[model samples]
Target: MIFEMTTQVRVSNIEEGHKWYETLINKHPDFIPHKGFVEWELIPGCWLQVAEGELTEGNGPLRLGVTDIEGERERLIKELTIERFEIHSRPEVPVKWGTFRDPWGNRIGFFEYLDKKEEETQIKSILGTDSSRV
Candidate 1:
């Protein structure tokens, strides 16, 4: 069976979230924004959703994988005009990843696969699988 998950993120302001999402969509054309949700289609008819809503205190944001880390960060800050975010401290994990918060205080992580070896290692580390599942 195929199991898919949808992560709901709470944003203090939907309008700001929409603008942030537009920045992402502009940078990554593969992403499509719909209403309050942004979708990434990994396969045919299989996708993931980044939705905006109300979040309680201590709730975290979503971690998204990216091919370019520095560029994404630059665009988010320079183009999107998102401030008041910080890169979270990461543990000694197999993958190279960084975390940042949105305008609404949602913590989002950005990960970059350094190489095929690192990518495989990250898949195992994240999914507890010996091989790629996606």
Candidate 2:
């Protein structure tokens, strides 16, 4: 019965948090119900919430699946001025990934699947979009 979900990331200030996330996610949030809280419905029922509060240490490297992790990492650096982070991978792992922290220190990362066909299938299922779009 747990059909929907949300993951929250805390920041010290809502104003800065909102602006940063908008830039990182490349769009405005799906909803901002009140002050100090904003939410993005990343895909259908999955939500990522940014809220105002003391940032917790050792929180997360909430890895988002991408079709091109290197491309996305470079874009984040150029656009958001994110510090360059290295991409790491191994034969045992299915994807290569890179990690970085947000301005408020929330650990976030991007991952690209090794198997293109599998990545395409996931993109279609999760985003309900054409595989080419991934």
Candidate 3:
């Protein structure tokens, strides 16, 4: 059996969006940097592409469930000058997740399955429970 998924994100400037994905791939370990596309090969024969857009409301691949949410978020803020961006909601998902628009008005979400140990620690800290129980 074979399975594949492709998603698209709209952008105003393909060059800028390409650069953003390039930086992300360079900074993150999971991504395999490609000239025209940034790919993440989660497993053999399965990959995700982040590439250039061909239209005014450009459509590039969608990225979801990314493990390095905080790092990616910081990089986007530092590198790209987003015209306007907003966090639609907090990380209420089992996996820490949130959405934001890029400089070109492309909507993207960053997320990952929460680390069990990290989640336990976070819950304990919030409830003022003892570390020993975590």
Among these predictions, the greatest lDDT belongs to 2
Candidate 3: deviation at residue 92, Å? Answer: 8.0
Q: lDDT for every model?
A: 0.61, 0.89, 0.54
Q: Could you give the C-alpha RMSD of every candidate to the true structure, in order shown?
A: 6.0, 1.2, 8.3
On lDDT, the stronger of 2 and 3 is 2
Q: How well does each candidate superpose onto the true structure, as a TM-score?
A: 0.59, 0.94, 0.50
Model 2 residue 130 distance off true place after TM-score fit, in angstroms: 2.2
Model 2: how far residue 13 lies from native, Å:
1.8
- Minimum summed lDDT over a 10-residue window in model 3 is located at 81-90
Question: Model 3: per-residue lDDT, tens digit, 1-134?
Answer: 55565444434455665567556455432453655455555333445455555533544324455545776677777776433333333456567666776566556666655776675565565446764653
lDDT of 1: 0.61
Clashing pairs in 1: none
Question: How many clashes show up in model 3?
Answer: 0
**Whose TM-score is higher: candidate 1's or candidate 2's?**
2
Q: How does candidate 3 fare on TM-score?
A: 0.50
Write model 2 residue lDDT over 1-134, tens digit each, in one string: 89999999999989988998888888899999999999998778988999999789898888788778888888889988999999999999999999999988889999999999888888898878887755
Off by over 4 Å in 3: 10-14, 27-46, 49-63, 83-92, 117-134
